[model samples]
Target: MLPPVKKDRVITQLPQCFSPNAALHTKDGFHPQVKAMCQFQRTATVSFNIAKVIVVGDVAVGKTCLISRFCRGAFDKNYKATIGVDFEMEHFEVLGVPFSLQLWDTAGQERFKCIASTYYRGAQAIIVVFDLSSVNSLAHARQWLEDAMKENDPSSVLLFLVGTKKDLSSPDQLSQIEQEAIRLSEEIKAEYWAVSAKSGDGVREFFFRVASLTFEANVLSELERSGSRHVGDIIRITDNTDGHRRRKRTPQCC
Candidate 1:
């Protein structure tokens, strides 16, 4: 059975680092031009209620541990690398509506790259995890993101740069690594988060933020696809006295 949805969850807005206009071109690919438009009004009913979230990064970066911590509330001390790809379904209640998120964990080894990359398509959110104590892991984030973005529509996918094993890094070391992580996050336009799976620090917050932001984005995209049609635009009424007249007009927004 899946975990129950938390009703007290409150996600007011997207983080400051999130930008809907961020450049989403993959490496060695043509950058598509996109035009910005004013925010359209959303209907009461959401067209999409499911979101797919993919986690990608280098080996031994704790991608599995992070997901386990969020989903099962437990972490494994044994280090077993992911083989190809694994997934888990998480339920959420966003803005008083029930929603579902599919979390995909891809293998970070080169041997499984081909198999894992095949599952990257149609992802609603991509999380790139790195080891805070390993600088090399941080450097490879760009390549991982490129591989995943190549199979997805970059404009529609939300990106996040996560640093795992926060408990292993010293305060001084963490500060230095954070600077570099911030620079890379800005370059890729992905949100930055630091968490310790073993200690369970910042794990819940990170997942909640991801779920909320993706939910909001999904709602907005559905509204745009619906072409400005508001909910309850059509209505019917009858007059008993006249019995032959009909009237209709677009409902006014209050």
Candidate 2:
């Protein structure tokens, strides 16, 4: 596991999820309530040591593109493929809790198959992305789901079905194809979402939904740790070490 924080603070407990929702990946699939990112208030970054994430998908499904947009807030239209796994990090505060996401975007081609397993280890969340235009990539979600489940810490690991490049697909086609993909996500007890990295559609939502889920998981983990061990001077709000380095802003409490 990476260092809990780039620098561990003397403070004890951190704040909990500011979002009111209790769970993610419901029977309805995509969340209708999360209209925009749950942004934080302006404060000095106080890094909290927290969760990790992994992004998985078939080649050309916009996995790397999604990370680029989310982490760097920039996009590239070029088609250079990821050789193995592309990496990026972002620090943000949620519900007054500072957190960092070490996002690993993996290669989807068959030649890169062996590398996926190694990357999947110790992942707190797995995003399985598929192209809305390709039945083959959409169908591949099954394999991606199974491989993610192989890691098997259901409570800590989140499995999400991400449909990429919605801009290229006709509206009818996008909805029709997404319905089928969401059905599969449901079958596997996962949530489904559509995004267009090029157009900046659902890209942030896709990641924020995962962050919300991870936020809940982190709170629970912290609670468990607090109960099991005793600590003093705990500040409810905290930012991760990497978060401190990534962003200077602090999150507001709900």
Best by TM-score: 1
Error of 2 at 114 (Å): 1.6
RMSD of 2: 9.9
RMSD of each: 14.3, 9.9
lDDT of 2 at 53: 81
lDDT agreement with native, every candidate: 0.72, 0.62
Residue-level lDDT of model 1, residues 1-254, one tens digit each, is 22345554434333333222332222321111101111111233332256889999999999999999988889998958887888777766654444566788888889888778878999999999999999999999999999999999988999899999999999999989988988888788898888999999988888887886776676567556666554222111112212211222222222
lDDT of model number 2 = 0.62
Write the residue-wise lDDT of candidate 2 on 1-254 in tens digits: 23343232211122232122222433322122211112222243343535668788788888888888776668898957776666666654445445566787777777776765666778888888899998899888888767866766876677777788888999889778977886787676666777788888877666666665666565555556666332111213443343323412112211
